[model samples]
Target: MIEIQNRAGVERARVTGRVVGNMLQALRTRCRVGTNLLEIDEWARLMILEAGARSCYVDYAPGFGRGPFGHVICTAVNDAVLHGRPRDLRLADGDLLTLDLAVIVDGIAADAAISFIVGAVRDPEDMRMIETTERALAAAIEIAAPGARLGDLSHAIGEVLAGAGYPINLEFGGHGIGSTMHQGPHVANDGRPGRGYRLRPGLLLALEPWVMADTDRLVTDPDDGWTLRSATGCRTAHTEHTIAITETGAEILTLPGR
Candidate 1:
């Protein structure tokens, strides 16, 4: 379902987006080398509840995932990328960690994700991969505006990832988001410009750009049935933001703050 929020709905969306952004920022600051993934999830849960927001992940049982997620945040480590269920293991130094979160406040939902190294990262390759996704996400956002085609956003993201030599995965990408976490107007990471859905004001989208270091193929983890990892066990990085289309351009709602 593609939803265009009215002024009141947009205001609610902004509130929800702000909450999600603030929580993510706090979680990022709290995550350290010695922290456990499950601990991160608990912290996120408490923060969301304190903010009077509801998690979009917990109790979510989608077809792709084999469960009610039962967690507040996705804690992806190293080769793992999407739908990474939090575990009991502690984060080691230099581990590439990705946190994906979505929450709803006043019936408006917002989502975002970030990837960073746990401690002192000596691997240049990991840093490069992390940088590439962030750059691609920024590129994609730059092209998002009223009257723009969905393909334009995808093309912008793909160009950066491809130029960086990182393999792109199309299985899971961005999507329209408003009252619900996942909605219509599917936005892929790679496509031809001037095609697909046309953009309009008040349309909210969760634009994410993720890439695997060595391969594009993703394998689902057998143990958890949710965590997606690179087939070759190579490292990966992902970055995302929730934005609302305005009359002139896109307004990023999930940014950490002023």
Candidate 2:
């Protein structure tokens, strides 16, 4: 469903977005070499409870994914990208980790994701991939404003990723997010401008740009039923933010200090 938030709802969305941002910042700081994925999940649970908010993923049973995610946060590492189920695996130095989170506060929800290297070791290719996604996300957000078409945002993102020599995956992309984690208006990474839904004030959208180093195809883990990985086993990165379209422009609700 597509939701248009009212003034009060948008205000509440700020609260939810701040919590998500803070949690992701803390989780990124907590991740280290040898840190278990389950530990990250537990930390997210604790932080969510402390904030008096509920996780959107813990009971999420969407058809595309395995029933009942049963985790507070998604911890994708290395080649893994989306719907990364928390496992017992421990992170290693140079691992590219992605954390995606969503939560509800005062009846509003916000979603965001971040990817970064694990420890002291960093690969040039890995940095390039992560930076590409971040730049694409920024470009998308820059075009998000009242009266702007959704395709404008998508086109902006696509321009960055495609120019960076990365393959864009069309199956999974950004979406309208409000009372629920995922909603209508599937925002593809690449599209023609001047088409699709027109942006309006109070519209909350989770804009994400993700790309694989080699191929656009994704493979899900057989055992866990989630955790999308690159088909060629190449590196991957994802970046996202929840934004609220405003009268003049767009306000990024999921910013760390928001």
Candidate 3:
């Protein structure tokens, strides 16, 4: 279902977006060398409770996933990318970590993700992957204005990833988000321009661009039933932001301090 926020709803959405963004920033700062994935999840839980907000992922159970997510945040390290379920593993120096979070405040939901390297080691390939996704995400957002075709956003994202020499994966991408975590208008990472849904004022979309280093294929972890890893075990990166369409242009709701 696609949800359009009214004026009051938009105000609540801004609050939700701010909470999500702040939590993501805090998690990224706390995640360093030797940090446990479980610790990150616990921190997220504490923050959500302290803010009197709700977690969109803790009880999320889609057909694609095994069961209830049963976690407060997604902690993907190195090869892991989307739907990364928190584990007991300790992060090592130079490990690429992806933190995806969603929360609801005052009945509105916002989602966002960030990818960064742990500790002091800087791997060139990892940095390139992270930069590529962030650029792609920005490009997509730049083209996401009211009355703009969804294809325009997709094309912008695809161009960035393709030009960076990374294969685009379509199995999972962005989506419409509001009162619920996930909604209609599946925003693929790669697509033809002038196709799909058209943008309109009051519409909310979560634009995410993710890529694996060597392959577009993905393998789900059997043990946890939530983590999505690269088929080639290559490092991956993801960047996302929740945006709201306004009369003037697209407003990025999931920006920290906004």
Candidate 4:
């Protein structure tokens, strides 16, 4: 389902995007060496209610995941990457954490993710992996404009990750988002340019670039059946932003103050 938001829809998306951005930013600040994953989920729940918004993930039951992801946010630590359901685990020093969030406000929706190191222990390898994803996300957003194809964005992201010697995974990537958490027009992290759907005004896309330090393979957590971990158990990072295609270019709706 590819949704093209009208002006009013875009405005609503902005509101939802800001809420998501603020929540993520706040969570990043509150995260510490001993902070529990459940506590982070509680903080997300409170923030959503306080903002008068709804979590897209709380009742989300997609075919790829176990039915009904009963959490407000995804807290991925170390080896975990996508769809990381919160658990009773405390963060540790030098742990790489990824927080992915999506919410709805005024009937519109937006999604975003951020990866960072917890505590004061910053491993060089972890910082490089996190920074690589951030750079790849920025590259994709820079090329996201009217008339640009989805492949263009994917290619932009792939160039950065691939150039940094990281393998690309296709099983999970970005997607169109509006009025719901996930939508159609799957955006892979790597692809050929001049192919796939063309960008246009009002189209919203969540562009995310994630990579494991050593491999492209992913394995689902057997215990919870939701969290996706790296096959090699290597450190990983992910970065994302929801952008709305505009008349001349794309506008990043998930920025904190935009």
Residue-level lDDT of model 4, residues 23-97, one tens digit each, is: 899999999999999999999999999999998998998887878999999999999999899999999888889
Per-residue alpha-carbon lDDT of candidate 3 for residues 61-146, written as tens digits (9 for 90 to 100): 99999999999899899999999999889999989999999999888889999999998757788988999999999998887888
Tell me the TM-score of each prediction against the true structure: 0.98, 0.98, 0.98, 0.98
Question: Model 3 misses residue 199 by how many Å?
Answer: 0.5
lDDT of 2 at 162: 97
Candidate 4: worst 10 consecutive residues by lDDT? 119-128
Write model 2 residue lDDT over 152-191, tens digit each, in one string: 9999999999999888889999999988899988999999
Clashes of each: 0, 0, 0, 0
Candidate 2, residue 27: the lDDT equals 91
Off by over 4 Å in 4: none
User: Candidate 4 versus the native: TM-score?
Assistant: 0.98
Residue 58, candidate 2: Cα error in Å is: 0.8
User: Could you give candidate 1's per-residue lDDT for residues 29-80 as a string of tens digits?
Assistant: 9989899999999999999989999999998998999879999999999999
C-alpha root-mean-square deviation, candidate 2: 0.8
The C-alpha local distance difference test score for the whole of candidate 4 amounts to 0.92
lDDT of each: 0.92, 0.92, 0.92, 0.92
* Every model: Cα RMSD to truth: 0.8, 0.8, 0.8, 0.8
